[model samples]
Target chain A: MGLETSKDPFLTRVKQSEKDTFMQKSVAKAQDAQWDKREAARKELGHWQDWRNLGEQIRQHVIKYLPDYLEEFADNVEKRGGHVYFAKKDTDAVNYITNLAKEKHVQRVVKSKSMVTTEIDLDKALLKIPGMNLMETDLAEFILQEDDWDEPTHIVFPTLHKNRDQIREVFQKLGYEGDNDPTHMARFAREYLRRDFLQADMGITGCNFAIADSGLINLVTNEGNADLTMAIPKTQVVVMGMERLVPSLKEAEVLDNMLSRSAVGQKLTSYCSFSGEQVAGESDGPEDLHVVILDNGRSNALGTPFESVLQCIRCGACLNVCPIYRHIGGHGYGSIYPGPIGAVLSPVLDGYEKFGDLPFASSLCGACTETCPVKIPLHRLLIKHREVMMDKLKTDKAFNKAIMKGIGMGTGDPALFQMAMEFDHSATLPFVSKKPTSVENLYNHEGHITHAPSMAKGWTDVRDAPRPPKHTENFRRWYKDHEAQKGETTDGE
Target chain B: MKVVVFSTCVVDLFFPNVGAAMVEVLERFGCETAMPKKQICCGQPTFNSGYVADSQKTMRNEVDALLSVDADYIVGPSGSCVNMLHEFRMHLADDPEYGPKAEQLASKSYEFTQFLYRVLHVIDAGAELDAKATFHRSCHMTRLLGERVAPFVLLDHVKGLQMIPLPHIENCCGFGGLFSVKEPEISKLMVNEKVDDVVSTGADILIGADQTCLMNIGGRFSRRNLPIKVMHIAEVLNSNVDMSRVRYANEEELAAMAGGRD
Candidate 1:
């Protein structure tokens, strides 16, 4: 249930999510709520596109000089007396941290929510260690943990599919008694996690941005749980995707501003901090700091057309505007990254065979690209992914390819297409009906095709397709008559 | 000036009145207009579906057809298809010949309102429309084609038309051509919400520049038996007929609607 959720195929996943009315309603409502707030937050900075350009420029620079930045960032981290482990594979990352925990005789482990952790299945890996207790401190993460690890539905708001009552039910099983009010649930969860924070032997957190010049990691949260995750533990491990590096604090701050605004439409999250290993005099920071930089197929995207996916700040702005995501929810994508970014990034990470279908899920409405703060041409990338799947990676699409080729041949020739158009009416007219009638076991009824065969059934299943016109000759005739009448009348005038 | 009008497939077959209106409007604006019989679909059906190599045929054919005509401007009633035509250069970037031809066509091609306002600089075509309308800014037109202001500029000078902002008007109408069929559930929900916004505006007519979207929204409207009339802005602009009455969707009423801006 990590990257590949169901393995039930793409359309099946879409069907399952479509049937979840509650999930559909919640996502729609969330998208509607996020619209104005994102706009207002973006508007707070005058000439927001300038900020986007700056953001894009900064990310583009970092990704282009990634190795250099990584060298400088790792050097600075070690200079600050921190350990840097550049993990080329997820297994390397998992083994390094699990081995460290074993070496320290770690008993109780706590973690702040991290998508990278989910990507590498670090939780599952850690749980493999016997005689160790682990907990997810982020409230949503904790709830999911308690529910036996229900997958996250969004990047920023992970438990988007869960309602307050469902949460109350999850918490009630942990010896809680309260109404479905969020405040009460937060208070109870705070007390519950506060006790664990005290006993937490090792704290692991996700890095939102890693400032390369200073070797510092930045984390943003509303509950300040990440601050606690860093402060309370003697041993802290920060897991970050390799692409999360910013050249310096100036660029980091710029992206931080954009990320906050784009992620949750906030001026700033309640807690935004830059932390490194324990400073010489610092009493509260982690005595032993480990920064695990996980490549995990990111370098695969480095020189490709998908290089801009590395530009993603994980703002999830694309998700809020995506129409398909609204109906199918995050689970439909079957990847930790969902929406426009996921459609582009997942195939880049996992290859096109499994994740190729994700790209086609989008309508290519350009909404995602328009709202992107970093100015990623998300819609175009989606198309590019489709191109790679169709032309390069995929071998089983010959039928679809043949069909498209045939269409191309038809449309490329005006005479052929016009002839096809002429005969299409009689071909389709057999299936069309004037109204839903008693004597019908067929494709159409009531001036619409209610049911259709083959791939066309996809549409008819949801909405009725309009019938083709009975006569096509009248338009050309009308054009001729109109031209003649206009010629005659204007000549007289 | 001579104008070659590309009546998009939706216009050529389904809604000829809209095409007729566009030609009449351009003609009345003192431009001689003609529709070439050789033109066909924009190949978006294949191109957008990730068949760019195959869709190239339609793209090449389109470039050939439009380039065959010698006109001051090549205009079309569809923002989406015109945007597609403008995209031919990018698609045919490898062609030594068609690449330059694509650039030339894209430069000369414009959506109808775009040519009217940007090139002709004619905001008012001396046409009067007596209807209260809320414009659905189709995604391709406003966002992709960057013709956000031209349609509104033209609508502003109509003799007797009242316009109000649609709530979250930038949201898409779920009519991504093939998307309507490929992901019908989401498409249905999206268009339904778009219709809700149109209904919320309380405008009698829902006007847009693209017929694909108009048809999608209008189809849903008719299916639901909603009382709103869907129209192309070209038809509205082409009308010089005297109005017996004008419909209204006032600022106060707009504000009264749920989710309205102050």
Candidate 2:
């Protein structure tokens, strides 16, 4: 499920998500709760604008010299006796991780929360190995794992759609005698997953920031499962999106502070660890560490106008502010990278034709841009995707193309524009007359269209469309009357 | 000062009265207003939807028509449209002809309150309205155009008006031009939430600089028969004119519209 969670058409998937009232409520509640906290946290972390500018500068520097950084990072990893694999595609990344697991003959794999692993469909690839057993160490992931590998709905809180009762139900399957409470469920999960952690032969984690100077990978989490995952296993594999790197721990530290504030409104998560290969005398750490940097279409964005998308820190701040995401929820996007970041990043990775509707899913309200810790101009990038799909790819439907073409011609000529305005009301008169001319009743005689045509039924379903007022009822007519009465209108200067 | 008005296509056709109020408000500030008849749409509907090549044609026509006016400032009642005027430069950056004109015109183009507060330095337009009202901050106006301080400053000086802060006022009303129709379910949820936020403030009149937002949020308000009046910022500023509330949908009229029909 590498960002391709839904094969259904975009509208169909949107409809499915819209019908999920529980998910919608959950998203809205989470957003409201996080809004004030995020605001306060950013205010507390003084000079938020300066901090954002610094964060943006750091990311821009890393991305501007990404090739050099990658080379330096790989070399540093090699110096630490760790292997670095640059995977140009999802399959390339997946094969490398699974092949490594196979080489070790690792039977039990315990994982921390890693979206890049999900992007490469790593769990499926690893599970394909014969007799391999895997468990998600995070509590949310464990609940989803118990519920039959349910695809995560959010980047941070994957099991946001599940309630306390649902968690208890999933927990009961593993012989837990606890009430339907979060603390109770977490305690039971810890007891249950501890055995897997101790027995696990392989550990897989997603890198939040790959510090190039030190060859260390940073993992930030509220659950602390990541710390356990990195320390427990003899063999460990770190999956990272190629752009997730900083020059050193200094840059990583600034980002970690910002990420905590933007992600969950904390000063920091319960665990923010910078782990590298095991020291020679270390007692418990992976002797063999493999870091796989995945391109998976991210390289497609590196040199384009979309290069800013790689600056995203996966803080989920955009999702918290997204009004559209509040209604349709994360699953509405039908991608592993949900909400604003998903809209921008998905089309770049999955091509415009495959994910054309993803860009159009936004209201372009710019909330994501405002709340973004790294200031990724998420809405502008969404518009860029639309332009790429329509103007460059010429992938928009012919009907829409024709209408837009007509708009171009009509607006370009003042004569045609005035003519259209004069006749627009009459042209729409039949629809708005409400005389039961047709059973459809697209419009009411009150001059308001109650229902839009099928292509635009979404508008009419929620609100009424005003009939274009004829003659003096329009603004031009009102302006004419007001100006005539004033007798003071000027021509140019 | 000479002022050229960009009465957006939405106001020109559906809400023409707004254009009247805008002119009146501008005149009160000792500004002469010019209406460039060659104007039509701002090319936003097409540009936003990604028809860059076609939208550029409309944009070039607009940039040329707007440049024909000899005015000190170009103002529109809408921040979204005015911001698009600024964006015209970006759209035509590759074009040798319109690119420079786009920037020249965009530099002078301002949203109504933005023009009033920033250029004219007039906070109160010497008009009064007796009602509790809350202003909806259009996403483009506040976040895009960076016109936050102006609207609040002007709304402050309105006589006999109580300005109550809307809860989560920064949230969008879900009127993304085509987005209202393209993603209707999400659009409805957002507007309804906005309506709830508005009603919770106990304000009878909802004012905003952008009517695109007012249309979506107001349409839902009218449909729900919430008795909340929606007015463009221009109308609120032209308080002496005694204009009626912009009716999006008359519930009684829509209900009785089918009356006595077979």
**Candidate 1 per-residue C-alpha lDDT over B1-262 given as tens digits, one digit per residue, 9 for 90 to 100:** 9998887776655566677778877776678877788888788987887777778778877888887879889999988899999888788888999999999998889999888776666646666878788999988887788777778867887888999789868678888877787777667877888888888998988888998887677766655656667678888887774333222334553343323100
**TM-score of the second chain in each model?**
0.90, 0.90
| Top-TM-score structure, candidate number | 2
List the candidate 2 regions with Cα displacement exceeding 4 Å: A433-446, A452-458, A480-484, A488-493, B241-262
lDDT tens digits by residue: candidate 1, A1-493: 4566668888788878878889988998899999989999989877898999999999999999999999999999999989999999888999999999999999899899899999989898888788888999999999999998998989988999999999999999998998999999999999999988999989999999999999999999988999999999999999999999999999988999999999999989999999988887887889889999999999999898889999999999999998878878999998989888998998888887779788888778899999999999999999888777666655535766666677678777877766665665566666564664221111121265557665566665554455544444434445777899989999999
For candidate 2, what's the RMSD? Answer: 7.7
TM-scores of the candidates in the order shown: 0.91, 0.92
Ten residues in sequence with the least summed lDDT for candidate 2 chain A: A436-445
Q: How many clashes (backbone N, Cα, C below 3 Å) per candidate?
A: 3, 1
Alpha-carbon shift of residue B216 in model 2 (angstroms): 1.3
Per-model TM-score of chain A alone?
A: 0.94, 0.94
lDDT for predicted candidate 2 compared with the true structure: 0.83
